[model samples]
Target chain A: MDMTFEIIGWLAGICTAVSFVPQSLKTFRTKNVAGLSALTYTVYNLGVLGWVVYGAYLKSYQMVVFNAVCFAFSFSVLAMILRYRRRSRL
Target chain B: MDMTFEIIGWLAGICTAVSFVPQSLKTFRTKNVAGLSALTYTVYNLGVLGWVVYGAYLKSYQMVVFNAVCFAFSFSVLAMILRYRRRSRL
Candidate 1:
């Protein structure tokens, strides 16, 4: 891959990875996941995991790191959603 | 790129692209975006747009197509959130 493409990929990864911050913060603060769909998040996390595997196969360190962070953020949000939902039901 | 890497990329892209469907469906069904963060969606859209640009640069048709679909889904969710927030305010 060219240097330009590599740089662009990093930029893209950073944006996507950081984008989850606000949502996670909101979920943590509000504890309101009424509009959040557990199914969608579960599927999204699977996709991120796929990226992690792909990154490992390609030996792209940046891809692996970014996707890993994204996966963590997504997983946290999912966990929070589940916790809040369970609490609501109880 | 190796065929394996390319195949993996395609699979990852498809997974991420299609993952948005359930969220979009739920949003439309409930018209409830209270748990969805407009900030996150907006930022996520930017990241997807970055992927679209990167794909164009790479001449990767699969990347372009999948990111395009993902972008549309994310944008629709953001728009719905904005609309709902406005209506709630009114």
Candidate 2:
């Protein structure tokens, strides 16, 4: 096993997992997805769903756990944005 | 081979790849990372780097191409954030 790849995996996993912070912060702070694109969120949500399955198939806990958390967070933000958008439109 | 997985893979692949749009948009539109976290971006950049390698190892073109594009986009945002952060602080 290449130790470098292992390190890479951990690094990538953590980074990808944590990368959602800005959006979350923005979502929380602004309480708006005014500038955010709905299409992007929809696509991302689908992607996270994919990661979940991909990780499960690979039997890699790292992929599964990381993507799961990321998915939850993304979903939360997406929901918030959608709610805010709907309320604003109404 | 499960066709379901292939569909899921494409969905996840596209979702994950396109998911960066909001961030990219925010980065470009806002012209600031004021609300964004540097640590998160740092970790994410590293994660994209790992994905590049992981994709290569798995010989999955979806992984490689999607990650490569995402990496470039993420790196661009990261760089912009760093530059903006520095300018504002100075």
- Candidate 1 contains a number of clashing pairs equal to 0
The deviation in Å at residue B6 for candidate 1 is 5.6
For B1-90, candidate 1 gives per-residue lDDT tens digits of 578776777788888888788889889899988888889998899898989989898898888999999898888889999999899989
Q: Which 10 residues in a row give candidate 1 chain A its minimum summed lDDT?
A: A1-10
Report iRMS values in order: 1.8, 3.0
By lDDT, the best candidate is: 1
Write down the worst ten-residue block by lDDT for model 2 chain A: A32-41
Model 1's CAPRI class? medium
Of the true interface contacts, the fraction found in model 1 is 0.75
**B-chain TM-score for every candidate:** 0.90, 0.88
Scanning candidate 2 chain B in windows of ten residues, the lowest lDDT window is B32-41
- Using TM-score, give the best candidate's number: 1
